[model samples]
Target: MKRSVLFAVLFSLSLHAFAIDTKLMVRAKAKDAKFVGSSIGGAHIIVRNTINGQILAEGITTGSTGNTGLIMKTPKDRFAQLADDKTAGFLAVVDISEPTFVRVEVISPISRKNAQVHASTELWLIPGKDILGDGVVLEIPGFVIDILTPNTHQYIPLESIKSTGLDVKANIVMMCGCPIEKGGIWDSEVMEVKAVVKKDGQVFGELTLANPSRNLFEGNVKIDGAGSYQVLVYAYNPTTGNTGVDIINCVVTE
Candidate 1:
């Protein structure tokens, strides 16, 4: 009898050790394109243990469909996860003792044959407990520019960027002779410009570039809505015509 009781106790503990709860769901859309070859409409999910920087689990799904659900387990009470949906992509989850930070990367693939073949990645985080009331969501949109030297000036609207959550500060970085400005001409209504620097799509640092200029401006701005933002960078001289402006990096810090 004693041996049987000990055996049952150990078995119960072992089952509980590996139990996991689904914490996040991700979705992707391939706009203006069809789901072709393995290279297109393909997506994957990855989970990581944030505390020790170890990967917990990973899997793949189809982007042509709707949202793909991802579940992960935690060793401790506090945890974080990063999710990416693209070719050669992964999602990561992390565990932290205190309030910690993690990174998320979303890659939008464009077809060389068709510039309109744009891919967008969306992520959602589901909390396990009610410790943090009304969890915050941050969003950052991606952009691409194709310009020909000598007379291809274009103004990419910042409103084209998209995100699902709040608390995301936008950061802008650019090269020389790129005229990047943000603000409204009437009553200071021009949308505020935020700066974010990201590695692998996860936000590391943030600043606000309100009515920013070419001086590498940085500051903090509050996000009022949840959606896409267009990142605009133009040539200071229209006569120079069509100099390419690259939005080298962006990040969201919460």
Candidate 2:
């Protein structure tokens, strides 16, 4: 125990002589797109000195674990896990001339299908500070939904068929102002969730959404009589007591 503490202290004193090594763990999630965090290529990642705005490092976040980003330093000691679940975790050394704060930026490229993603986070560090337990979580917030499915704004050919009910199914993504991991977002304190449905500008109906699975809300909406309609889906998360919304457009034939 004394040896570990002594080594840590000595390393702190040697900051002026050598770069301070540290590990940076991050999680990326896509709300309206897929793989933006775990598999959708990588983001234009960067770490900058918040004091001078000078960039410290550049890289991307990829792989199945959402870590695999700009890794500049290797851990001096082994790390078991950071939070409730273990993250593959991105690692950065962050060469420090003195103890200070730094910023992390991850901007995901435009999704081939849906939207874009960007993230900014800041953390304070001391030279030779412990970099293991729970570390800093650089959360990259992606879009709002994975895909509206069948896409939106569709004209069913004014005379295509004769169906009474319009069935709308979508896998909605809800972000509880939390971090992302393993195809999902964590940090919910609520037990009840609902998806408020709307047509045009008026409340149509509401559907109780099941527990989210893999960052998606599995729900459906049935509209009996339709004209030119705008379908809106609002996901209510009681956790932070916030609601996320998305829209779908469709035209029903006469």
Candidate 3:
């Protein structure tokens, strides 16, 4: 009987010494916008052990963009919950014997590689403790700028280009896919959009894009006998220090 009791006690102690599964929730929030979710291509989440660089958990956030009123409109007090059960997040359960320092990385709007922004943070996680409810919110700053004109690797006749200047256009929106319009939530008036033009690796010129409609910025670039032209369209919100860029290459046949 004593031997059996001793063996049982040892087994219990061994189990206690083993690692505990801790729950961690990670979310990607677009700066000045909302959560990065399935509608705009969910954010890729990676949680790693900072000391040994071991990836503890890896997954993509899934769900909605979250409540806009709570995230954007409402005045937030201390410890206000901006996310709900449906809010997009990646829940990771990590097994750790003791407190471990971890690095959390998020690549937002994963579908749009051209406009994807990376954000990361580090914190110590205690065993058996779960960080849920709004979790670790990492803010991604930038706009999603997609160049609409001068399609990627497009070839245009030299005569056609000379007749009319190149029309540069882009679709600009917040990283969360929030529409940027005049006097809207994301005001376009406060942002600047431009297209940097280049020819054969030489600086050609730059054009200030004007917003003619919601989420659309357009400009005209005077092609100076284009030869292997490249256009990079970018959007910058000076007030928020947010910016994003998308590039396209086209050839003007001589």
Candidate 4:
């Protein structure tokens, strides 16, 4: 009789050890006004059962004007095995017995030119161990942009740009060097700027804005330098008006 009781108790504990709850959040946007090629502005959220690598549930959000958001939930144990893999990019994992929700964000850019202007959603997930029973935490220090110019007039400081739904605070630094002849220029007339969210200091999500060049430059600018420079962009809280800075570095070649 005692043996039967012990067996049942162990079985219950085993089942509880592998349980979990998960959630996801997502957003996306476009960079340029032209919106050329296969640039479909949309966001998708997914939850997978890590034990067997099976997709449990998925959701999507999209917009033509350039922004979207979504939320989802699932069991905690569904991703327990996946948490052990460093390359998995799992931000946070909850206890198998407790209810957990993992939030995810996906933001796609319209083009490489747009990527330079906004660089939206480039924040990465910085994983840490020994917390919440070996789970991951999300961190986003912000996005960075590097600009190379032929002269000081071409410099676009981060503080000069404007963003929707987020505040802008940026750090700009100039490196001394000579100018490059016809090498530091892009074909696009306008560029898009993007901002992504960071849980801890790593990028977890992003958003892109159209025609960022209007805010960055007042008139036609030229690049004539062979040095390096950096521009940082931060996620601003629209309600609080608090600004965060993202960083970008650029190299000009002669």
Candidate 5:
């Protein structure tokens, strides 16, 4: 009886020791742009076991954003590899005794809080199997919009608002930190940027923002002797249906 129990314990230990290293590559790609990589403070990656709520691996991606021509110009075929070895990716190697299901989460452009995107997916990871070469691309949809004028929670006098009006200016960029310019890659002309104004929680008007230079949109909002004003600036790409927004609240004191 003692020998049998000892054998059982040893077998169990052996079985548990038979763990294999599984590799998984995760990449965060902008909706209409390149991959989110080191230049833009690479994406934060988290890998967790769904069953036990245990974290397997966590780190940030490091590499280039990826090739522009291959990602933007080339006609992609099914299973065509768009990312090369230099492209940014977070490779998580987890040791597992059996097939385990995991949830992968990615927060991209980690440097920009206002433009960060959280995306996740679940998949089964087989022991000893590796997923690489453009594996599990998470698409982040939106622009990074920052309101440059009329700072949040700022105070302005009503006289100044009625005299010169509020100059609305914003800086907008892709999730990958790609620049939006006129007649260039990621064209600004194809995008529509505007500021939605509100006074005392009521709709005031909308101001169309025109691109004066690369990644800069400027416009003027006419305030009706403002009370409490809220400005919501947004960038929309109708072609790809990608959009982003930033908001600010300013008090127009008498």
Candidate 6:
């Protein structure tokens, strides 16, 4: 868990810093609950347009010299670290099409199993001159859960609301740094998965979600009237007392 080893990555960007070309010395958190300690072999790192979802550039972490010497020209002594360790340091180069915001997607192994059982996280990046400084810092979250209804990012349809109720679901998983179905990992059997309803940021009702799948839980809410409503999903594990929460906003109209 002590991924605090010092390293360097240098990008020769004088003015055209339109892409992520740098060395990464991973600086881990104080208590990273999801640290796997070893490189996530064969992980795919992608930099893309957040709005249009267009892929700008992509690279794969090979736990060694996949793109080290191929992309690195004479890197400075500060860029001495190699991409030999996935959980530690590496060289990453990303091309940005335009000066706009972007999203970095990391889909990596659920342990070293070819990353076939994979997990992903989307970290946002602002338009910058270069991908220097702290390098690309990405957090493989300890858990993953998001609103899975309406098949979008926290957006619910206005017409989908009926007088009876509205159903909202979420897919929750534990990032134990290993495969789930393989049994050597922490499971996603939530102790309590509840959807707390709030109107204009005021607390109102909370419903305990019912599990429809091993990794999915859902709840129903009947709205009297809605301008903007917030559905806060909270998932807790009694075994570890670890919790994960997410928020989704919906606007209902006639």
- Best model per lDDT: 5
lDDT of 4 by residue, 77-106 (tens): 644421222221222232334332323333
Ranked candidates, highest lDDT first? 5, 3, 6, 2, 1, 4
Model 6 steric clash pairs: 9-23, 20-94
RMSD of each: 19.4, 11.9, 3.8, 17.5, 2.6, 15.9
The TM-score that candidate 4 achieves is 0.25
Best by TM-score: 5
For residues 51-149, what per-residue lDDT tens digits would candidate 5 score against the true structure? Answer: 998999999989998999999999999989999999999999998999999999999888888888899999999999999989989999999899999
Per-residue lDDT tens digits for candidate 2, residues 178-225, read 232233334322423445555556677776554345444445556655
lDDT of 2 at 237: 44
Q: Rate the local accuracy (lDDT) of all candidates.
A: 0.31, 0.51, 0.91, 0.30, 0.91, 0.52
When 3 and 4 are scored with TM-score, the better candidate is 3
Candidate 2 Cα deviation (angstroms), residue 104: 3.1
lDDT of 6: 0.52
Better of 1 and 5 by lDDT: 5
Q: What's the C-alpha lDDT at position 12 in model 3?
A: 84
Instruction: Estimate, for each residue in 156-251, the C-alpha lDDT of model 1 and write its tens digit.
Output: 223433232222222222211112344311111123334443434444445544433432333433433322333323222232222223343223
Model 5 ranges with Cα > 4 A deviation:
1-16
**What is the TM-score of each predicted model, taking all chains together?**
0.26, 0.54, 0.89, 0.25, 0.91, 0.44
Candidate 4, residue 178: CA error in Å? 38
Deviation (Å) of 98 in candidate 6: 41
lDDT of model 3 at position 89: 93
Give every collision pair in model 3: none
RMSD of 1: 19.4
Count clashing residue pairs per candidate. Answer: 34, 4, 0, 54, 0, 2
